[model samples]
Target: MTVDNIYDVVIVGSGAAGLTAAITAKKNGLSVVVLEKAPVFGGTTAFSGGVAWIPGNPHFQDRPDAEGGTRVDRAAVHDYMRHEAGNKYDAAFVDAYLDYGPKMLRFMERETEVEFTPSLYPDYHPEAPGGAQIGRSVTAAAYDGRRLGKEFKRLRQPLKTITFMGMMFNSSNNDLKHFFNFTRSPVSAAYVAKRLAVHIAHLARYGRGVQLTSGNALAARLAKSALDLGIEIVTEAPVAELLHQDGRVGGVVASIDGQRREIRAARGVVLAAGGFARDLARIKALYPHVREGGEHFTPVPEGNTGDGIALGERAGGHLSQGLPNSAAWMPVSKVPFPGGAIAFPHLVDRYKPGFIMVNPAGRRFVNESHSYHDVGAAMIETCRGLGRTEAWLIADHRTIRKYGIGFVKPYPMPLGPHIRNGYLRRGKTIQDLARQIGVDPETLAKEVETYNDSARRGEDRQFGRGSSAFNRYLGDANHKPNPNVAPVENGPFYALHIVMGDLGTFPGLVTDTQARVLDGDGTPIPGLYAAGNDAASIMGGAYPGAGITIGPAMTFGYVAGLSLAGRIADHRAGQAAE
Candidate 1:
């Protein structure tokens, strides 16, 4: 019956979407507070690649060069979305996203600590209608965690599997290139040495690296902006239920610092609490692999357990269903660490030369260099009747040492640890490797031989590995005719078992163009809005390009803030005239 505090807006979640909404609302003359269930504030965004796929981003449009300088056409972007989403495409939502996504980016960069650099990442399906080979994706610029002062400690750390000694690398290939060429190139050696020295100093001073990159940098920048605007970001606050009365959502009852308190929102409540990817029961019902008795692991924060969706449902919102896919699928392998194991999404290694993915039967099913989503979908469908949605990544000693596989790093980093931990399997010959991995020797040998035949000729007769622009983008350009094709003929082959995983869920609470949560009858639940993974993906279960999820999440979050602010402004204007 007693209320603890109140604000014009209350945002559930502190990821890119929630912080974006808070920043926008505050800038638009509304008092806002962000509540995060996790002790940390970044949600899954901090652990992500920090890239956003904005079709007409101002950064790319301002410059035209051979890399990604082509002007983005709105019509073309729309056509591409239509082709990617197929029947699930919602024109109203798509229009809103396309119209506001760029504006959102501009606003954040101009008004906050946000900054972006155009990326060379291509559309997942660059050959699709209206798809561009480049100029659509942009990643957050690297930021210094020192800017956040004390709040930097609360920022979620980057995925450990991808970092070295808690030191994160930029998503740009340039940073990795320097490390990869450190031994061969003198210039790179000095660069790596300097980077390592700086990282060591940062570790000593901050107990973690202060040079933030990727999603961590994005999260830090956003948090700094929110704090600078005098917004309250309350962590360890989990919403228990929505305060619904008079046919509208007004506030929330949340456990804050061990006390259940009522916090009313005079204007609206925005839900951006990641997604339901970790909600086992709900995923088992929605995810086909889980329903069919397969394991699913996610690298996102465990705090994202469909809290936003559940809260929306309690406030008369319904989840969107019947999408082709329920989540953004990715192939992940378990990397044995100190305690147990961690989910490591195979984002980089597969595209390198001399790597191939084979099912349990030792047959190649898909082009290993394809997008992670495509490869994951293929893996799921290939293993549908096999009871487990899984596959194995095979590589020769040369390739394994040159590029590494899964969480195992390149040469100079001993493979003994991985081999001892049973995370990696090795064999001196093809037949020997097959036996170690539980595959029939003859079948495995024949598959390798068949693949080598085409690989030697710089072609994939069966699966067209390096045929697409997107595939080649991730491939080693220094390699021969086919960057993604090479013989796996070297002895001492290595194999890692990979299974189905996801970046985030796609099926979420149904919402309108304004990001308003919708009821079963397609009516907006007043004062309740959804953004980020809490809102059904505008891409409609399809991963169109890099940063597809983050891009739209931010756009809709901006929309939700604008919607609430606009409505209040209109009401006040009418009253003032009276």
Candidate 2:
């Protein structure tokens, strides 16, 4: 038994969760190493919007008008959580998260290079009790990847489908609006020009854009912090098995550079490996649509294949059961490539005006402006009733040119390539588009007519499209009457094939409040912890807001690190005493 190395903590996965745990553990006077199966770090987080739904964050503490302002009411937050989690609400876990989440945010910004700015996003269901229209979600500040020096290449880049010529845009909506209106507004044009110049310069020097934004920036900042703390991030190292000895998980057996190596952990091993989104067999069993023999696509890193979950289950950790949904549902459209297609999540385009999603019958099923999860769930149920598994996002020529649909860019970007490649379907009229998309011409025409009647009046009486703050946040604020409601009476029309997908899995390894992986009987497994998508989501499989996935991930990572360092109890005692 040749032991290659030993550390106080071994974090499996290098996404936001693992890197956060590594930094926290190291800062608490423990040696930590991060093992990532992929050639690069970041996991699915690198491809995300990079926002965290962190209530009571300190960013706007002094601003009374802000959501995170002095008026932050803990009881209201608790009520919202209870409403969101419903039957799956675990009071202890939720309370721990609420107590420690803000602390973690403050610590990361103060003690490390990671920084965040308050976002203007609202709660997905602000109409719910105790929900606020703003002040909860925060986005990672854009970071210069050049600061990482030689290791910059190891940081995963944003999804190529979302980036323009390899340049990532900020997820705060400001950069996107500027680019969208560049041709019409001089101020926006100037901003776009400056941004393009910087991106071009970066490409010439770095072979990739070094001005990282969104989740890529978050990943880079965390990686830099971990590296500065002397934490070892071993990429291309896949943990094959858990090291269980004396009723405790001590370390892992990882394949590093095609060589097997045994690395031991003195305190514990934290399972922060991405999730089971790509794990075919597991997802087939857990995901409703997949189990029904429907197609599912995901844009997450392919390296996430349930490695952590399998390792934990093998070591006697319990897999949580009976969540309403198994993953953070996302509606995605396949973008045509050279040889195949890639899943592009419909994140921003759905909320824009002059567009509506329809079923095979050409009828609008769900509110297109709703959160991705709610829309996805509705999509699944709608398709199930129709005995099929697909939907179409219908848009007019004017709308498509203004907001763009799916992978197709707005005006001047040239939609010819997408149309020719069959990634986009277009027609000269409403009836022509219905035929092009395999729907009844008369039915689609009638549906469009009915929608336009209400749209012209700035109302969605059927589904209440623009009835919430969250819906309007992603919409064009300059639009008249209602930002999300506009008559689609233009000549030419287009349609995009939509399918089911996910941001990440929800139901995961069952763990206690301290992040200790629990056995089937709810007994804690010694020296074993889980965070990130590897652990069961605290939101109980519900989509609460913009950053629900990453928010709890980071908070639990902080908790797990504290537990590994034997400081969690002391901290809890201090908090209780306070």
Candidate 3:
């Protein structure tokens, strides 16, 4: 029962990538160990909305005809991603990913007990010329961490509550329908009854149910499988340094319970310790405009502070600059959580009509309904010469009363205490509001008038506001003329200041297609690999689909595991032959 001094593979950060690597290596009969920096396993993966974009998946092809049964063309997916990334993506890495992603998913499905289902959610770039509606996203079925027995304590449950059985349980428009129904009709009663019955059945039998969302489900299932394979996950063990011999990784120096321990990796070591979002100083240094003071908006975990990147750099690894483009950006309301903050789901759906956002010069900018990336890019662009980066969401009485602006209930309340105390402004007229927010009152009034005219005509000629399907999908369906093209007609307006907030920093150690960490010369460091946010992202600068970070993390980790273990076996055989 003595603890082995060396393992075949040592994986740092027991998130999706680390766990996936451990499981794959163990399956190949290689002794593996995982070290997690946080108190629990499953880093940010558990908190994400899981939707892996797996092109050419078989399950999609096996779906019913009405559900659109057919494999996604590899070429179409590649072209779509290239166009989405604006040709900034690494062609070789992306091609390798597209070729192997489906195969990796299939391998995990066939070899392990993890189960997955296709999601009907369209690609985020569904309208990008080559984008399609169905067959693009896949999610794991809910797994009972309880199945891991003692290992359950080591796994991290989602920081938020998750819905079971692919049920319309997460933040979706369906939540609104359910709320209205619960308050107004008996149909809601019947629907609740059926949903409750299904939950009960799943709890009594499988110990878990599917979720309408995919991220949480995927993390739980991966954790369960890793535990079942006897992979040892040591929590609160942060890898501080990589042990090397002749320019190759030999082991790792890890901190466990404040005590340092050296765990040798006879075969290799993998770094998946995530990114530097929580580190305020690093963020300001790298991305100055996106400051960390004012109102709270980031949903990222506090522990994600670039431990992996630091360790890799200490070991002479190269880092990528534009990789920060992989960061997750969002427009969040000023709702305060205990240690962090979260975007109120209602605000996203509510802030459509009677509101328009403007830059410091008081001019309408990009489409208000564009994805957060485009929004963040626009914010950065608008504030290019302003000496600071900031924007304002202008809304009037109509929007306040109709959709409920803040996180507080009944919505019409003028900027809750959180917003008012932090970064929000209110006034009786557009000019007054502009003055208070430090914008040109005349320009602000003119922008509002122009927007109102467009709203009256049921069109946005400036930005094609309602043109994209993705924009309209998240728009207020109750609006007339167009769901996304509403004007600022009502007076007694309010404007809330907004800055670009990110989930985590995405720039990190550069890695090859096999997830092997590379050195300054652009050569892979033998016996060293990285995955997830800890490594240079495979998506290059674009966020193509939901769970892009976790999906590639898991995929590349699987590949790294197989490659490393095979090398170990080959080494042993060669030694025997000698």
Q: Which lDDT value does model 3 have at 114?
A: 62
lDDT of 1 by residue, 1-578 (tens): 22248888999999999999999999999999999999999989999999998877777865543433344586888899899999998776666666677778878888899999979888889999989888889999999999999898899999888898988988877778777667777998999899999999989988999999999999999999999999988999999988865767888988888999889899989999999988999999998988999989888888889999999987888888888999989899998777877899898899999999999899999999988999999998989977788899999999888888898988878999899888999999999999999999999999999999999999999999899999998888888999899999998999999989899999889988778898999888899999999999999889899999899888889888888788322221322100
Model 2: residues with Cα > 4 Å off, grouped in runs: 1-4, 62-71, 385-387, 570-578
Candidate 1's error at 449, in angstroms? 0.8
Candidate 3 positional error at 44, Å: 1.6
Q: Which of candidates 1 and 3 is the stronger one according to TM-score?
A: 1
Quantify all predictions' global Cα lDDT against the true fold. Answer: 0.88, 0.88, 0.68
> What are the clashing pairs of model 1?
none
lDDT of 2 by residue, 153-252 (tens): 8988889889889999899778899877887899998998999999999899889998889999999999999999988889989999989778799999
**Alpha-carbon lDDT of model 3:** 0.68
TM-scores of all predicted structures: 0.96, 0.97, 0.82
By the lDDT metric, which is better: model 2 or model 3?
2
Between prediction 1 and prediction 2, the one with superior TM-score is 2
Query: Which 10 successive residues of model 2 have the least lDDT summed?
Result: 569-578
